[model samples]
Target chain A: MAARERDGLKAVPYRSAYRRVAWFVVGALLVLGPVVFTPYWLGLLTQVMVFAVLAMSLDILLGYTGLPSLGHAGLFGVAAYAVAVLSTAHHASFWVCVIGGIVAGTLVSAVFGLFVSHVRDVYFLMITLALGMVVWGLSYRWIPVTGGDNGISGIPRLESHAGLPVSGPTPVYYVTLAVLIVCGVLMARLVRSPFGYTLRGIRENEARMKSLGFNTWLHCYVSYVIAGAFASVAGVLWAYYNGFVGPTYVDLTASSEVFLMVTLGGPGTLVGPALGAGAIVLLKNVMSAYTHRWLLILGAVYIVTILGAPQGLWNLRVSSPPRGTRRTRR
Target chain B: MSWWRVALVVVIAGATLVATAQPVSPPIKLGFLAPLSGAYAQNGRDILNGLLLYLDEIGYRAAGRTIELLVEDDEAIPAVGLTKARKLVERDGVHVMAGALLSSTGYALAPYIDSMRIPMVYPVVSADDLTQRKRSKWIVRTGYSGSQPNHAFGEYAYRVLKLRKVATIALDYAFGWESVGGFERTFVADGGAVTQKIWCPVSVHDFAPYLTQVSRDVDAVYALVLGRAALQFMRQYREFGLKDRVLLIGAGTTTDEHVLPFMGDEALGVITALHYSAALDTPANRTFVAAYRARFRKIPSYYAESMYTGAKWLVAATESIHGHVEDRAALVDALRAVKVADLPRGPVELDAYGNPIENVYVRKVERVNGELQNTVIATFPKVSQFWKYNPSDYLKQPLYSR
Candidate 1:
């Protein structure tokens, strides 16, 4: 098996050096973005980065594992509410709130994962959607804890370990950028690892992988949990950035938006989801300023993208390459 | 001539042109943010049309400055509203902001507007906190707060209707809670007991279950439903045979004029309270109704009236300061100081909290010439947002939703 994998890797040379250089340049520009743009743009870019993290997490399950989830925002929203409630109600520290949010999100997703991992196709989608609706209902109906539709407001900014004010746009942007880069690198490695390969094999042919002594359901459950944990991180960042959390953040519209970002960017690619998030967020904010028919324009763009670039906007260039031509050497 | 000599000559010519150019004062950019494309689009468009109509009536010039309106859609979402509001202030550099259609959006943008030091006039969003506990100096609510009409309705329900016992069937949200709380406070204080409080979900399609749960012993039912939900609840209430059994009263939005035309005879004789009514017999309201109907081809709802009043108030304040909106603090002060004695909705003045102290009309949904109308039955004069309670006392209490 190892020899066959080595031969597969040998079919394509590694492009690590080129990829590293590209990342370094991207990182530099992201760091300098705050200084170059106005505060408004900085705030918007910060939101884009936060949502990019969320989109990438959704990509992990939908792209890699072939697990379509409509409840991704459920995990994200629960974590946000956890952080919001803890920070506002219990006055928890930033690190404690972050940990609490991630743990809460993971726990909820684990339970949901356990229940839905065995299901396939539309059933999985339906179950996940139902779960998402349940979370939305809780947030909307639980007046005492979630503040109902008005939501929990007056959330304080993130306090650093040194107790410095790290809640401003520049600091938040840098923090989000650093987290996004680290998460992107880790996620890339995860998808390339042996375990990640197993998940992909399962995605391609679950029966073949299962017959080869693989626990496909276990793999999917773990992947779902991990994806949910990452989504929670984005949720915490969002809650703090917006200084508020409401049911709308976790509603069906938000979940569908995450799915749209993942699919629109090229589901399987790490950078695709982020790019997709950036495109959609920028479109909504920028186009909305010019015309009231922005939603119509957005729908038109989606239709055009689907028709012109079936693989995705980001995959336009890569479509020309043979399927295995771009494979990297192990 | 050499290239450098020709360049120098052109530079001199450009400098001379610059020096002789008249300094044109930039237009006063007034930003209007509302949900122009989402659930409340109709209400939003009506508000915008009302504002634009006033601008058109005044020839778009206010106090020697051309009033340039910068409109943006908030999509009725808080986050979107905040983003659009920021764009309006930061990118377009609007001198004044106005026209928010949702309470949540208003609540989200209020603190941001205060931080930016931009004076904002709210037309329709009526979260009570914007005027009470969370009041900002830079914000003036030209529209009614959630509690304003409800407070008056409570009085009317107790005094005029002579109801000793009532029940509330309100939408389960901040606005609903505020409306119910205001009614409960006043009704209970006026020697009336609330028999039951039933909260239905905002998106409930069938309100029959909730309607059946409403106590039959109550003298009146105070409802706080809005939009299609209101339509559904009213239809169901009548279908369940409860409408005739009990006195149905509510906030004016329950039988909004915009929806009344389509509500048929189902909404007739329904009593509600609000700050504005198109059926107001005053000369000012008569003129406003005529102009609005002639322009929009529809009777103006309270939202339109509020925004029209808001625009008129801004114009009056701008005229008072001779169009100097550059000084936001002075403009806000002028806005707060100017009292409208004969506006479309009658006399209105800004209270200390910058919320309007106006007459809340107790209106009845009556049919006149086969057209549904909110006919003013009684008026609660000089009602403040705090109702009869002291300002500080009201602030000590948490928000109704909380």
Candidate 2:
């Protein structure tokens, strides 16, 4: 017991040192990635960052609260459409468009959460799928408003209210990077807070949480809306980046892709989803240039990842226990 | 010193020598975006084959420079299309682009092409706005607009066929809406009434309920359906015995040459109008058809013809400019100025909108040597995209939307 306590004490400084090194490396990459990457790769990295935000939002719902949403794209696409319509039609300022997208996404999610909050498991999945399809139908069939299958195009690049030009690929990538960092920090804080603990408790034992006087449904509802709002942030950036929005963005295929990213990354891990997004987007954009069967390669990677490391690539390492854990337990 | 350092030094020296030795002109890279692996893969293949066939005939050289073609599959999604297009421009550094089979993809790409200042030659996306309301100087469409052939068909149905009452059925989308709109405008102006108009969803598998609503009082029915849907509609129309009761007319793609041979007798006697027909008895068309057949082991469709024409136009423009596409504006001007007196589709000229002004042939599906063919019976010469309507006036009207 004394030897185990000594071993535990020895692990503390080493673990903290490891963490500091990891963070330092991450900071260095974040600062220098744009400089190192070519313009084309920068564009791709920007897309990866945008999708990372989206996958992280999905992770918050499915991984934390165990909601298993299939209509995440509906929120994302609605926000994009809102931004597109306001900016194109009303000529709203950039801040106004961004807020409008977030509000629209939040409101839609609130209403949808009200409807589906009572359902659980497969029923919830089906409802979300149906909701996604309805949004897609609206975008596709409402030709006058949504521009039908052609979608809304020619959205001007984002500019500050003061008319400072924040356009072009480089400026846009930096803007997206800033937003991603802010969202990542906020989400990490949210998932570690007391409210986050309650969510995990509910996920593990809903009845037990209910017995403990927790309003599980309200918690789920709030998480759902929060996830939707985060997705909208990604959508707003995407709309500004692509300068276009179409029904394809809201379709079931897009929602399924986010779910794939969440699962392929370690679910419930903040950075895992971002890594997954990077891997998937890179595999698609980079590998596609060299070969036509990139999808096949992606599929092979997915199968290998699933079979070899079921907890995802992020959790593959075997680690020593942290210092003081054995001492505290004893 | 290490062997690797010596190897790196030799490689740098070799690169410097090659850079200084520049003899031949650099190759002009042309990017081709198409749906190579999705629902529209077959159509994409046909278009690519047509473009490549022309290049092959020229021995892959134009304007004293080797022409390099880069193909990317967009999977028929607009977002994917835009991403691939950007990759081609920013990464591959392609000077020009061609081939967008889906209208949605084409529409999404219009602004990007303008922003990048690269010219694009559209082969088979027939969105009218690309050449009309939202026309861009950077774009030149070698393919027909959605409304072009329908306008001619409307006139022919009213004048030659002597149809006073016509009903229309089409897929409920931009292409369908524009087609019927063009037909309605022309038919109404010619003192003919359209009895009924039916729009079915693009993914609709059953056309029974819609077919039942087609009024028997109409003198003829004009339908605009594409791909497998066209085949399904034709077979169902035959099964319902409506073919014997009323004259059936359609947009050119309803009985498109690509689908006709496979359709057997189901498409017999169906009349339509289009810019190109393989059976167009002319020296240029005969030679094109022969070469296409010899190369691809099949008769060329309008898609193949459109891409072939686009390739020919690109070659002509490149030759005129002595392969100097470095000046984008000059290249665009050169492209606009060149007029083809003889193409597989006959004489073609670009209107102010950069859309083709070419002959529209009114053809019928007939069996020739036990194989189905679109046999041209009437020709509307030198038809513009706007048909007889004044361009300015047409642009004043709101775009056709359902």
Candidate 3:
């Protein structure tokens, strides 16, 4: 027992030192990535950051609260469409577009949360799927507003708002990096908070949390809204970066894609989803460049990811805390 | 070890240098972008095969430069299309670009191509405004507009077919809306009343709900369905027993050669209008059909023919410039200025809007020599994007939608 405590004490400083180096390298890469990579790669990196934010937001619900949302893309797409319409049609200011988009996404999430907070497991998944399909149908059928299948195009990049110079891929990459870092830090803090512990407790045993007088439904509702807001942030960034928005964003393919990111990246940890997003975006773009059978290859990757690393790629190295210690953390 | 050995080596090096004295020109990179995956893969593959066949025929050489083809799949998404287009232009540094199967993708890539100042040939996109109000300076379309063939068909339907009443059903998107709008305007002008209109979503799996809503009293039903939906709609229309009663007529794509082989007796007697058909009995078409069939072992659809002719058009433009495609403005001007009378699709000339003015064929689906074909019934020669309407007046109107 004495030797085990000594080993734990010796490992603490080494882990901290390793973490510091990792942070330094990550910071350097984030700062220099745009400069080092070509425009195509820079564009891809921006997309990765956008999807990272989206996947992390999904992790908050699926990982912590045990709510597997199949409609997360609906939330993301609503914000993107909202931003696209405002910026392109109305020519609204950046602040107005951002605020309006987030609010629209949050409102939809709030309504969906009311219907889903009480449900569990497959029921929650089904309800979210139905709600998402409704959004997709609306976006596709409402021709005048949404531009139907063609979608609204030519959305200008931030347009030098406040003289930020975000017109090109390089500038956009920095902005996306900033957003990802902000969202990542906030999510990391959220998952380590007492509220986060309560969410985990609920995920572990909702009935037990209910008996302890916790309003699990209210917590779930609030978390859903928060996740939606974060997703909206990603959506707005995507709209500005891509300069286009379409119904495909809200489709089942997109929903399943984000779900796969969370599942494959390692749920319950914010960083895992981010890593998963990076992996998927890279795999998709890089593989397509070389071969036409990239989708088949992607399917193989998914099967291998599931079969080989069921606990996720992130958990392959990091040792998760024991259940007894996990509860004692707070 | 010897002056004799050094002298022989120097002589051999000199002989090799003299053999390669002429400067070799860099290969002209041509980027082909389309939906190579997803729902539109078949059409996309046909386009690529058609393009490859033409390149193969010419030995992939044009304007004294070796033409290097770079293919990218847009995946039928606008954003993906734009990204792939960027990679083709910015990364691959393609001298000229071509191929966009979907109208939405065509619209999405136009502005970007214009901003990048790259000459692109759109051989398959049928969006109307692409050559109308939203015409791009850097792009020229070798294919027919969405409403181009329909304009002539509507007039022919009212004047020749003597249809007094018609009902329209189309996929609920820009392409479908424009097609129906063109037909309605011309048919209405010719004293024909459109009795009913039905719009079905692209995701529609069953046509039973929409087919029952068709009015029995109408002279004909003008339907504009595409791809798998076209197959399902034709099959279900026969199942509903309405095929015998209603005179089934549609846009050219409703009975396109791409999906014609899979169709059964339900497709017979269905009249449609389009710019090209594999059954066209021209010498150029015969040569093209034979070559395409030999290579692909399948009948060349209008998609294939368009790309084939599109390749011819690009070659003509490139040759006119004497292979100096580095001059972007000259290349685009050459593309717009080229007019050919011997194309497989018949005579094609670009109008001021960079749209092709070509023959629109009113074809009937008939069993010809144990195979289904869009047999030409009537030809409306030199039909422009504006049809009989004034260009100014047409531009004054809003784009068709819903």
The C-alpha TM-scores of every prediction are 0.91, 0.93, 0.93
DockQ value of candidate 3: 0.54
Off by over 4 Å in 1: A1-28, A157-168, A320-330, B1-23
lDDT (Cα, 0-100) at B194 in candidate 2: 88
Candidate 2 regions exceeding 4 Å error are: A1-16, A159-162, A165-167, A318-330, B1-22
Mind giving the per-residue lDDT tens digits that candidate 3 earns over A1-330?
111211112346777678678868877887999778888888888899999999999988998888889999999999999998998889888899989888999888998889988898899899999999999998998888998888887776665642574466677888888889888878877877778888888888899999999999999999999999999999999888777888888988899999999888877777678889999989988888899999999999999998887656764554653241122211
State the TM-score for model 1. 0.91
Strongest candidate by DockQ: 2
Shift of residue B11 alpha carbon in model 2, Å: 20
Model 1: how far is A67 from its true place, Å?
Answer: 0.9
Better of 2 and 3 by lDDT: 3
RMSD of each: 4.5, 5.7, 4.6
Per-residue lDDT tens digits for candidate 2, residues B1-402, read 999999999999999999889867789999999988877787888899999999999999998899999999998889999999999999999988899988889988998899889999998999999999899889999998998988888888899999999999999988999888888888889999988989998887989999999988899999998878888999999888898998899988898877887797878999998998999999999999999999999999898999999999998998899899877888888889987657899999999898999999999999999989999999999999989889999899987766
The residue ranges of model 3 lying beyond 4 angstroms of the native Cα positions read A1-12, A159-167, A319-330, B1-21
Candidate 3 CAPRI classification by DockQ: medium
Error of 3 at B312 (Å): 1.5
Local distance difference test, per candidate?
0.84, 0.86, 0.87
Per model, state how many residue pairs clash. 0, 0, 0
Across residues B1-402, which tens digit of lDDT does each residue of candidate 3 receive? 599999999999998998789658899999999889999999999999989999998999997899999999999988788888888887888999999998888877876887789999999998998899888999899999989999998899999999999999899888899999989889899999988889998878999999999988999999999889999999998999889999999999999988999999999999999999888889988888899999999999999999988999999999999999989899999999986658888889999999999999999999989999999999999999999989999899998775
Evaluate residue A180 in candidate 3 and report its C-alpha lDDT on the 0 to 100 scale: 90
What's the distance in Å from true for residue A116, model 1? 2.6
